[model samples]
Target: MKVQEIREIIKLVDQSNINEFVYENEGTKIKLKKTETVTVIQPTASPDVVQGNAAVEVKPAAPATPKAVEAAAPAAAVSERENLHKITSPMVGTFYQSPAPDSPAYVKAGDKVTADSIVCIVEAMKLFNEIEAEVSGEIVEVLIKEGQLVEYGQPLFLVKPE
Candidate 1:
């Protein structure tokens, strides 16, 4: 789904009483859950009582500043450029560093790897895709954190070519 559509869905969810919702189209699926609860009470008592209740839960909405969003865009672009030689995700999914919860990671930040080294796993559609390095190099940085949902074409690591 488009990002704008997702944003609208989120807004609707924030203002409603729904707890959870899921939508799937083609091969993509999105699930959203309300992380906090908001309660509104009817005023059956005096006006002073309603005013006191209103003062109980007066939290301001926090919105992202335009300048902060703009700054993040360039930082993301620069990181992509720096990891141009590293292999990126072939599809969108949750990235995992190990095969299982108890297993060791396929590679570490400083590990040297070849074109065929399995650097990580990207889980999509209940399948674990073993991501490999496309070039021989030492891993300079791991761009994604464990259990993070990544987008297609997003950089997963940085490799200094050997």
Candidate 2:
């Protein structure tokens, strides 16, 4: 079956309270099971099939370790903090660093920028938008490449406090 069909079936199974479901259609067969603590497991087949029978097993009791969860939590927190005060795109558009092809880039990494400095340009619906720096600081990073597509709220740079 198609991936979309499989995804739809999985979604349906997740919404219902069925504990186990098995279906056979022509040459394809699928089995799904849900426990009191819901966990979905993908099926696997062994190379050697004895007596033309395949054994299917589900292992769903595995829980994430505390260390793994703790590691992930810090990463999420760091990303959230880094993205603060981001100069996001006002509209979906292609971003540019220079006013024209032959001109120099408006701003570079480590450059001290202010609220009035035009940091980049965003071309949206055939109009070029002069994206300005909304805060004053030394640029720590540039998040987008020149001529890349930028969406609304996409970060353009990271600024270190001056």
Candidate 3:
């Protein structure tokens, strides 16, 4: 499904009372659920509250100027990382190194891969989705640990092209 269409569906669900919705087209499927939460603010109704308020007001204000942080030497790392290609997550999910927990990992650092290689699996909503390498290269780094929560578009691996 197109990104615009998915965004539109999300908009409709957000404005309505619907808590859960699912849409499927061809091989693509999307599911969304809204969570309701309650926030409670306590009212201060005692003399102690007023005393605490007074104490807070008596404290000096902080300086407006922000402290400058030391800049790291990033030229070499930046250029090297930029030259290497990346494989990123297609959706938000928990990353798995193998198809099954007991199985050996599909790929690792220094391993060579092709465009169609099944490098990893991402579990979203209890569904296991195999992720492809999409480019032929030698994997330079495995960016995520097994069972890590991966965000959409987050880099999963770095590759040095073959």
Candidate 4:
């Protein structure tokens, strides 16, 4: 299913009282579960009521000025990154930079990739999935390290699209 469809499903499940939901189509499977939280309130002794007609004055907080936020990096660098496309993981799994140990990485920074190019692998449930660079571009960055646990929709690489 599409990412938008998955987002919609998540929204529906979150808004409803359902605790768990699973969906599978073709070879793709998605499972979503909501964590339950329990809140406990303890009874406390009530404060003694004031028996005097004492006058009380309340002071309001002074108005504060908002500080100007400074940019962390140069504007050119930020603009360059904004033009890049991100290749993200399709499932929660371990990220592999290569098909196997001792093997050269599938792709790295400065490498050109097509939409069908296999850029990395994500192993989930013992199944090694070949992740493709869906956008034709020159890979500008590898966001995740090898053997790292990656979350679904997490960015793995940044590409300068052709």
Task: Tell me, by TM-score, which candidate is best.
Answer: 4
Lowest lDDT 10-residue stretch of candidate 3? 52-61
TM-score of each: 0.52, 0.51, 0.57, 0.60
Reference-based lDDT, residue 119, model 2: 92
TM-score of 1: 0.52
Instruction: Give lDDT per model, in order.
Output: 0.72, 0.69, 0.74, 0.76
Can you list the residue pairs that collide in candidate 3? none
lDDT, candidate 2, residue 31? 58
TM match of model 2 to true structure: 0.51
Order of all candidates by TM-score, from best down to worst?
4, 3, 1, 2
Better of 1 and 2 by lDDT: 1
Best by lDDT: 4
Candidate 2, residue 135: Cα displacement in angstroms equals 0.5
Q: What C-alpha lDDT does candidate 3 achieve relative to the native structure?
A: 0.74
**Model 3 over residues 1-162: C-alpha lDDT tens digits?**
555565577677768755455555566666655544323243353222234212211122233332122225466776677789889887667999998889999999999999999999988777788999999999999999999988656789999988
Which of 1 and 3 is ahead in TM-score? 3
lDDT of 4 by residue, 86-159 (tens): 99887667999999899999998999999999999998777799999999989999999989988666789999
